[model samples]
Target: MFWNGSTQATIQMSTTTPLLWAAFRGAVGDQLPVILALISAGADANAVTRAGDSNALMLAVQSGSEVLVRALVEHGAEVDRAADEVTPLMLAARIGAARIVGSLLELGAAPAVRIGKYTAAEYAWHGGHDQLAELLEVCAGAPSRYDQSS
Candidate 1:
């Protein structure tokens, strides 16, 4: 343990878990080789960070890495899992990651799932991804405003 002068508190330094390191790398860079190695060495793909705010797949979705996202899902990450009230599909749509959203859909992410009052399609529309929003709406089997106009 060490004194954190900035926070005015004592902070215990611990070795970073493979999952946490992979999540951080997923968010900032596409370190696929390293992540795959860690996974092969027994890292749990579904493991969340200490704060319970992130996992490798969530960060991969946020980083817009479709391959990384798919790899994590195939390796046992829950595609529809939510962290801090936000699902991976919700994050993908909010960030306008069409391909990542598609991958998540193929991996069984529920298009109709919602955080509070909004679904993934709503997030896509709010993010200015009209075509993606329409796609998600169709997948969810919900009639979209775009359909009403046609």
Candidate 2:
């Protein structure tokens, strides 16, 4: 029972069980209703995909859907969990999704989370998002790189 890309069929398919597929579909399609329903039905918000080992929250973040990201977080998604070294906050910052970054921070995502040797703020800076870098720095309780007050 492959997801026919329809919300109804996607929800009805028993094959999308274990909640991982449902979460991935809901996030990829930006379907808040489906996401909420799956979560309410005991879907593991942190369930990782076999392909890239990414969870629903990571998918939502990568989709650039702030609403979906927030919804997943509210549903108990692990904010700091990383997929291949990239945390949700890092992904958001790399994409320059300021709203998603803010939401993750508000949900207790640690801005200090490092992917390899770089932190989320560092990733934002590298991505040319000065404001986002600053925001992450502040959230991590670190001084902004833009600050020359040293």
Give the top-scoring candidate (TM-score): 1
lDDT tens per residue, model 1, 1-150: 343463311121133476655555464566777778888999988877666776667878876678889888998899998888888998899899999999999999999987899999999999999999999999998998767566
Summarize candidate 2's per-residue lDDT along 45-66 as a digit string, tens digits: 8877655446778777876778
Worst 10 residues of 2 by lDDT: 8-17
Please state the error at residue 60 of candidate 2 in Å: 0.4
Cα-lDDT of candidate 2: 0.78
RMSD per candidate (Å) reads 4.5, 5.0
**What TM-score, over all chains together, does every model reach?**
0.82, 0.78
CA displacement after TM-score superposition, residue 89 of candidate 2 (Å): 0.5
Looking at model 1, report the run of 10 residues with the lowest lDDT sum: 6-15
